[model samples]
Target: MSGSTAGPEALEPLVRAVLAALADGAARRGGPVPAGPPDALAEHVAGEYAAARGEGALSRLTSLLAYGSADPADPLCAAHLHCPPLAVAVAADLAVSALNPSQDSWDQAPAATTLETLLLGEMAELVGYDERAAGVLTSGGTESNLMGLMLARDRVVGRASGRQVELAGVPRRGPRLRVFTSAAAHFSVQRAAALLGLGEDAVVPVAVDRDLRMDPDALAEALDRCADDGGLPVAVVATAGTTDTGVIDPLRACAELAAEHGAWLHVDAAYGGGALLSDRLAPLLDGLALADSVSLDWHKLGWQPVAAGVFLVRRAETYASLARRAVYLNPPDDEEAGYPSLLGLSLRTTRRADAFSIAVTLRTLGREGLGRLVDACHDLARAGAEAVRSHPRLELCSEPELTAFLFRYLPARGPYDPVRTDRINAALRRGLLREGRAVVGRTELPGTGPGRVRLKLTLLNPHATPADVERLLHAVAEAGRAEEAAEEAAGRHTGETGEETP
Candidate 1:
């Protein structure tokens, strides 16, 4: 393992150059994102990664994504909640990367292990849990949720004739275990079921009300039917804030249902966890305390870098399934010596110090500071929804529950045609993306009809105001008109020229 010819000393200049290039590109991104034509976009990306082993190529490579990618930091980039992170988070990330510490064990990462544990405790408190609550840093909502369901599966199987699933496989003699969740719930739950050997079919899609909240009565009836059919109830997954609509399920009612059915309760609050900071928004998480486990992703709402996810459980003892001991790792004598450890907490053996950034962000923003950001985004969503409803061309899809909107543009043309409308809306979104004018998102609106396209605006930029959102909608409308005009021109060309309008 000989050192490179450049040596470590050469990195200082390279790093500085990289940062300067990134900063320059970021500063220049003051306008809408560029949605370029096919050839241009392809060239930009090709030039970015084209040449290899060339001097100063890294600088050009940095500029490729730095300038070409849609800027989530820009208030106009209303696409997703993986928004611009706090500067402190970036700095902390740099420190962690430099230190290269792993929080898996006390000897491996003493400070990181301590910091992660304390931060997990603070996060548990935010979830309205007592001192008994235990948590571990995860990759994101998906891993957090996978472990939660894994725990539920083990417990359910254990209760089923005292089977230990870790040693013995999932019981084959009993009725298959079923997980209940709203249709609007995150897909991670189903994915978790598959990983845990429950099969995707193990999940039961409970209907949601008009507000997209899980219907408690429907869940109750489903649970009753499951019992009658001799189906073993495993867990009830409740969504605190769904990804697409940001809808919150009725947590209290879901908790009650879980209690009555003797099932584990897990709340997927990866997107909505930031509401716990705001007194106003926190109420939406009522009955969260009743959940057996909860997932939170600071990267989504806490203004932190990626991979800042936490999984909290009400009882610390429930994590016994993750416990493992080895002489080289957690030796028997070392455990008795009171050396604090976090090795048995997560699914990873060499976990990064993600909690370092999370701790710094929480301390930097405090609860109120974080809450204000959440409040600002929610206000912007309401304002944007109002703007949509008032606009002649735009129609609000559903009343916003969080900082998100699901709406589509209404063309000023002949009779309403779902197919034509969906096409125009989708084309308009792609046009906007290609031009980099606006980074608006698009999703199917099954509520309206199958294959229907609906424009989405996830207002993650806290500094953005209602006026900014109005301007965004105006931009979207203009793009829609241009897309419609292009479509009409193409149709007319096809009628006259009779050649395929490329």
Candidate 2:
């Protein structure tokens, strides 16, 4: 029997049980995360999927999984891109999943086709693109960046040789194709180059300033180097809200340079796109409008669910490279008959309705509501930095920029040993994860010591207040202090004794 054949009665028990588990989990998540050993959790989960004495087995499974999840939904979670999604967006996602619309062909998803276009248009406008702009819903920043680079390459190689690289493969142009991005830029740009057949060597890392922003002078120098090496500029990928530090590149300056070099400008605002909602923070993206293309991920800072990525281009023709005509999807007769289709302008033919959730979220929160959320995160981050500075164990590496702070801790009384410090910080993170008290992030400062072990605090929780952040810092400091103390005690014990049986 097909799983879908199960009646509502059969599902009712499972539904109620799941809801109950979810309710309990949510309530528990408000306090502390259950940071248990992964191996133990793995054993329980394995048994759940395999064993079958099962009357309320699903309830047992739900409870087990709920416990197993690190529960990043907790406001204490400042680790990575994970966060609790907006309620309105989750509701919209439920409808989307239930309806299950695929917007490739008009007949299959007429409303969704039109709706997604309108949504994309709204997003393009937000990026300061006019009505003529074109965009498509992508999986995330990686896919969006990939799409942008693909188009950028096609426009460069295609215009010169009058041959479609998408159809014929990377044309052997005389000048080697090159891409440029800030040293602080996301690694996705290099990935984009690799995917576009440009190879990783095509990516030129432009130097950044003290604040971790892409230096315009460095970009100019790199472009000149590319020219000197007999290479044509393909794209300059600017970043807004870099993953490690949340630093944004100089957008307007980068755009000017890209135009001067006749290269495509693609802005990756996956984490900082939420700032566009607020007039105050929006200026951070001052030259955003001038870009040839932009990438936005609503799932990151916009509080949407996973995979709310949008790839917007300045003109519809920018997407010509990705277009394809199929008899069943977009035929010649159908085109003439005014039947709309979205089989083109996307890497996937079976794309989900990612726009609906974003639309619902925007409608519910409006621009001001979303802006406040962004501002709150930014303000909280700055405040959190101050707190980190005042903390006994913690130290601020730099001021918070775009809701992210990178810092480290004082593990013990001894002088700073790079290797020992690295070990303490790593152990601190492990201790936190093992205890599941607080979820903070860790990063290594490039070219700093053996490894400049730094903690990353991504303030994405708008609801978290100053006190909440203080608590988070306190927890972090306590963990580090505890680990360092234990290590010191262990060293003392070793010195007192014969230093281990070995």
Candidate 3:
């Protein structure tokens, strides 16, 4: 074949080979993932990879971080926040990559930009925002939070007299722009403050209630103190769903306090924003539209692939603070034509059309279908919590608030030893992952004496039933018992207790 035609035809065979391999693997495994890892196949692939990398030229490129090695779709895979993408979303992602559309401007993206805008409008409506609401697509919750804080900072410091701060080079000086959030809130909020020239100390850590929700009274008191001291309280960051416990802060109360204090209210609803789809938990997000800015992650609960997040603002003009003009790119003539460019609204220059997958998923699963998925996961979490509480070996740390539960395995007939308990629980978790039996999560919570290390379960897989979670709990308990028995046997033979080894 000619060189021109051969290059294009060469990829055809490789694509066919990959599809054939995938079909055969799926058939042999009977599903996406088997009960355990394919040790032999993994070893063979590693050997081939090593040979292909060879000496100096490509050795550094072989990082051993190969794809398809971890079974994220397995019922027992519950360690991290990662999840397998839906088939529809995955297929749409492939097309997105093939198209390689840059959604930073209307001319560049066209249909993709419109799709993203429509989706953001839909999401804003779900949060009860009015026609004045607008948003921009982001990488994930972290970027969304960062963008939201940037807007808040701009609103507080920029445009005091209908003039642009950047064009005038206005020197911002005052109380240093402090923000407040609960202790249980995600770390990204503090990080955003740091990046924005507000030191970490500028992020005041507010107290939480017994259920881990932020206390509105405490927040109001904090604001009052700041006001008395002449400190600028710029924004109040509230967690709609905490990363650890999935507890949502009292949004309505927080909004009211923020308004009274003359501060911007930003809600980090990355995890629980999908609950807006659920009729039962939709009320938990009441007054969310009252927030000046909101952050959401479509990858977490929206069930789209990775890098689907959004940051919405109640007022569309808030983005003008970050606006810029470039002669070669977005010229003055183009601005007058009503062309929309995302460059003024984002921290990125070249951005992928991540919202394509989200648009496809939402179109495939309408509002009702998405809501049902969210409700189903919540119900499964409740069932799993009940099973854990009923079991003699496990103790529930708190009730199920969202699709997450915190608990620890308790040994029968003994006073809880903090060091030994931590070691035992850690070993059980490691064993679960190594043996592929389950991927039970671990966390540290305040205990009676010292803080105790505990386990957590964040159920995001809609296909995961209550029985699957029960099996996982039982397996963890059995592993814990075995570790305890081993510790007892070692203690009996030796004069030392298990504390020394740990």
User: Runs in model 3 with CA error above 4 Å?
Assistant: 1-48, 53-70, 159-173, 446-449, 492-502
TM-scores of the candidates are: 0.93, 0.93, 0.87
The window of 10 residues in a row where model 1 has the poorest summed lDDT is 492-501
Clashes of 1: 7
Compared with the true structure, what per-residue lDDT tens digits does model 2 show for residues 1-502?
A: 1134464456566668888987765554444456667686577678877873467776666766676665556768788877678878987886687667887888877788888999998998898999989999999999999998999999987776678888888876578888998877788899889878899999988888988888999999989888888889999999988888888899999999999998999999988787898777888889999988899998888988887999899988888888888888889788789878888988999888888999888888888899898898899999999998898788888787688888887765655566666777888887887787878899876565454778888888788888988988888888888876887667642222223221
Query: Using lDDT as the measure, which candidate wins?
Result: 1
lDDT tens digits by residue: candidate 3, 1-502? 2124464475455445555555554444442233344575577556756666434213222222222334456556665556667889987886677667787666777788778778888888988898888888888788888888777777775633344444553245655567999988889998988887776788998888887789888999999999999887878999998877789999999999988977889999999898898888888888798999999888887788888888899988887777776665577687689776666767787788888898888889987888888888789889989999899999888676878878888766367666666778887877665554676778776335433777888878888888988888898999898878887877732212434542
The models' CA-based lDDT, in order, is 0.84, 0.82, 0.76
How would you encode candidate 1's per-residue C-alpha lDDT over 226-250 as one tens digit per residue?
9999998899999998887898999
Candidate achieving higher lDDT, 1 or 2: 1
RMSD of each: 3.7, 3.4, 4.7
Candidate 3, run of 10 with poorest lDDT: 57-66
Pairwise lDDT winner, candidates 1 and 3: 1
